[model samples]
Target: MAEEPMHSLARRFVDAWNSRDTAGLDALFHPDFRWHIAVTDHGDPEMRPLNSRLLHGMNLPWGKAIYNKKETIDIFSGIFAASEQFSLDLRTVIASGDRAALELVGDAVNPANGRRYDNLYCYVLHERDGQLVLLREYQDTLLLFDVWVAQ
Candidate 1:
């Protein structure tokens, strides 16, 4: 077996996310991939699984009831971290043989209460034969839920 380059894989992940390609996102995951995260829920610890990660990530219904969203940020680095861009940060990225991980932080300010939510999100990836096989993601549900309040 051989190792695939990490930067290339990173590019693919970002490409999928920026394009909002659901299938492309799924293409990056390994079948056995698992995602985990610890979040605060009413002062209690809350954990999410792979299936839930994907399901919850499908995006809120854009049909009606909308709120303000921060601009899309994409962080990239070339020539080995010579430059840093906060807006486009990969969220957070970790890549190794047969495995890769990322955290996409989605933050916003609630107009109703003027509260800000900067959540630490992450995506766990697994691959085989140079192709993605499994993927899972984790994010702060409370932070996001706080922004999209129902009237």
Candidate 2:
């Protein structure tokens, strides 16, 4: 089968997040997927890694780090479980060959704090055999700290 266009794949990726569909994500990601977050200076210095890092899961300061597909699914499951509503709005997507970059904004209310969590994110995805093999995610770490840590 021909591969789906990268932009279309990116849309489906957002859909998977909005729906909290693990199976859909499994279908889209390669068996050995790797996700990287570009950590920044902000929040407690404790949260920053001593060195560069590549990890799975959302890696929010409040939770333990998760490092694989199953763990990632579990993390999202917990997020959905605690949220009254979770949504991701895709602002733009640019693709070429097997790579794509997506700009998005996410909004949700965590039942634990009744605080709204909203942030902008950029995802750089690399695909192989029509499946996402690598995802590099960039976001405002300070905003994350404000929402998930500062309280």
Candidate 3:
């Protein structure tokens, strides 16, 4: 069978996420999938403070550079569990060969604190055997801190 196209896979990924379908994610991700939280300050001055907060103030496991498949799935599961409504609006998708990039905005209401969780994101993904093998996600950490972390 021919491998799935990168564009199709990227759309499915967005759909799976919007629906909070962990089983769909399981099917889309390779067994050895890796996740990355893209936090860098070297190039973008706007990222400096957020990166510092994530690296120093958060002190959370998500601050780690890499996450294995189970950890990635678990983190998603936790987020879904915490929110009353969680969905992403896919803005753009660019894909070629085994690589894909997605631009999206997430909207959710976190029942825990009655706070609206709205954030923008960019995800770069690599595919292997038609399944996503790696995903690097960049998002607004300040909004994350405001909604989910701050008291």
Most lDDT-accurate candidate: 3
TM-score of each: 0.45, 0.77, 0.82
- The most accurate candidate by TM-score is 3
What lDDT tens digits, residue by residue, belong to model 2 across residues 1-151? 7655898789888999898887898788787765655453322223444333533333566332224566665666777787857899999998899999999998987666667778899988888888887777788876775566554
Please give the CA lDDT of all the candidate structures: 0.47, 0.72, 0.80
> Which pairs of residues have clashing backbones in candidate 3?
none
Tens-place lDDT digits, model 1, residues 49-77: 32465455443322222111110111112
Candidate 1 lDDT at 61 equals 22
CA shift of 51, model 3, Å = 9.2
Angstrom error at residue 141, model 3: 0.7
> lDDT at 85 for candidate 3?
78
Measured over all alpha carbons after superposition, the RMSD of each candidate to the real structure, in angstroms, is: 12.0, 6.6, 4.8
Better of 2 and 3 by TM-score: 3
Off by over 4 Å in 3: 1-4, 40-63
